[model samples]
Target: MADMQIDSSPVRTVNVTRYVTPLREGGSLPAIAEADDGFLYVLKFRGAGQGVKALIADLLGGELARALGLKVPEIVFANLDTAFGRTEPDEEIQDLLKASVGQNLALHYLSGSITYDPAVTVIEPKLASQIVWLDCLLTNVDRTARNTNMLVWNKELWLIDHGASLYFHHSWDNWAEQSLRPFVQVKDHVLLPQAAELDEVDAAYRAMLTEEKVRSIVELIPDEWLTASASDAIAADRREVYARFLTARIASSEIFVKEAQHARKSLI
Candidate 1:
């Protein structure tokens, strides 16, 4: 991002102690695992189909959501031991673990959380607007009602599963033209009906997400995850591009905010 020094207090390293169970909802196949710190974490493997870029998005996205005062599980650096793979009896999981025996990402497990249900849950309009605003700013396309990727732990909503964001990076050729693209998926956002202060939420978050704050989140991405070829000028500064995109989106949030607001009206 910028040349400013980023604080590293958010990055914590933990050793993977045991593989618990597989969460097969998405293609990534992330699993629940116990770590050396005596806490269970939902480990996101680097070798999964989405590869390193997904991990990068997960880290940065979670941090950005937290910055906007949203509740997010703690993310940590998971150090996988090569031998851990040999203990697995399942061939597919064994291969996956063997391939991911190094620094990976993990989200602290919420011991007893329920998936969000709009039919029963009563979300504050402000919180819903903030959530819709954050998802739009990040261009996250995975927050629809069918796949909310949100959890209700201790009777509070918590954000999770941010890897689906920054999908623009998948095909870099015409990325620039699509950088300022509108988020059409807001129409299906699960919390749209509960959102009543899109403009206020947008303004507050825009003011809060300064260059340094965005850069700090970008900096949390491990260097190895920024693996795109440095030969391309844009690829060389992959971190910078991510931060710039977020800052740009924040500056240009009016269109998306209006879209969200319009979607809210359409519900009436």
Candidate 2:
């Protein structure tokens, strides 16, 4: 998180004006839709197989990346009307749209961007370290060689599809304990071999992501999204849980940092 900058600007809200096409590449079946703002966005449906928890992960992970001065697509809250996708021929997509009629999540589409091919594109150690560190902090398990959830937009790396991050929330049984554990998945991170600056970035990132800042990022999650996932847990209580977990995790960054370093040693 060197040269750290926090984008505290609240996420914008948009209305989905049209459902252009579905992006079948992602298992969630996210689509490219045009919003009232006259921009194309990759819409992540609430009714997707992963459900609202995935939306929550997207918001948290994307915003946290932004907060840490990483390159991430603009995220927005999209409202889908009840009659949005009725005319569609596909029953599965139609039902998906119907079920996602309320609020959803979307990333401002980066047109003309190409998927990051590690073999062709080279990443400097610092940038690679930053990405690896961010994923470790969030315990993200998706950024692998097979499906590197990264893009080369404007010849720079842009992270996307964070719906698979923060997986501990899927079964909130031991979230607190899970937070302090090392992210063993860092070994498989697409950028691990290039992430030679893990130790250099760890302290700066931890200092930048203070408890207040972490809570602010967690608070960006919509109340309905939290309540939808946890019928028994109050939204406020859940927010605090996330805040505490992230804060504790950051405080223990040394643990994961060491693990990532060890993994990198094995690679080199």
Candidate 3:
């Protein structure tokens, strides 16, 4: 994997000291692990179910989330030494660690945070609107009511587990065109009902997501994670494809904004 520039600096690298436990499997093998820095992190593996692209989405989604002025935990590159897997007794986890030895993604753990439950909690409308707009732009498919993928640690919402966003990259078939496809799933988004100021949120988020910013976030993906091969007809440079997809999506923000607004109307 290649190095990526994050926050105007090369991504800081952490070494995994111990693999504590695996989170319940879904799209990828994420685990709670202790790191050399004496912190616990949720490690998303490249060798897992969704593969490196999921890590790419994780990095891109987190970067773009911060760009939109949303809260996300600090993301770091974790260098997994293959030796650590030898200590693991679980066959499945050991295999995952061996395959993911080189470069993986880690998120600073939130100790006492609980999953956001809309029934028991409510986020402000403006914040909800911003989150809705952000998810729609990335075509995030995992933010529906059942999953939510959000945390409330200290009376504030934080975003997490974005590997399921940017679903277009899973297939490179006319990927640029796919970028322009409307996020029809936004209607079912957990936040759409509370996205009170769609127009205002759209305007602000649209202004914030510049082409330069999109490219910057895309560049944050490690080069090895840029897996579109010469064999793939749609992209030789996966980064540019991601950039085009992002710019196209945001450039057509009005369409999805209206999509969310329409969804909101139906919801209320």
List TM-score per model, in order: 0.92, 0.96, 0.92
lDDT by residue for model 2 over 49-79, one digit each (tens)?
8998899888989989988998888899999
Specify the highest-TM-score model's number: 2
Candidate 1: stretches off by over 4 Å: 1-8, 228-236
Q: Where does model 3 exceed 4 Å of error?
A: 1-10, 25-27, 228-236
Q: Write down the lDDT of every candidate, Cα atoms only.
A: 0.84, 0.90, 0.84
The residue-by-residue lDDT of candidate 1 on 1-268, one tens digit each, is 1121123356789999999999988888899999898888999998898877788888888888887778888889999998897978899999899889889999888888999988888899999999999988878889888898999988899999899988888876666556677788888899999899888888898889998888877888777677632434443378778877887787788978988888789996
Clashes found in each candidate (C-alpha, N, C closer than 3 A): 0, 0, 0
The lDDT leader among the candidates is: 2
Candidate 3 local lDDT, 27-115, one digit each (tens): 57699998898888899988888788788888888888888878888799999986888978889888888888888999888888999
Model 3 — TM-score against the truth?
0.92
lDDT of 1: 0.84
Q: Which ten-residue region of model 2 has the weakest summed lDDT? A: 1-10
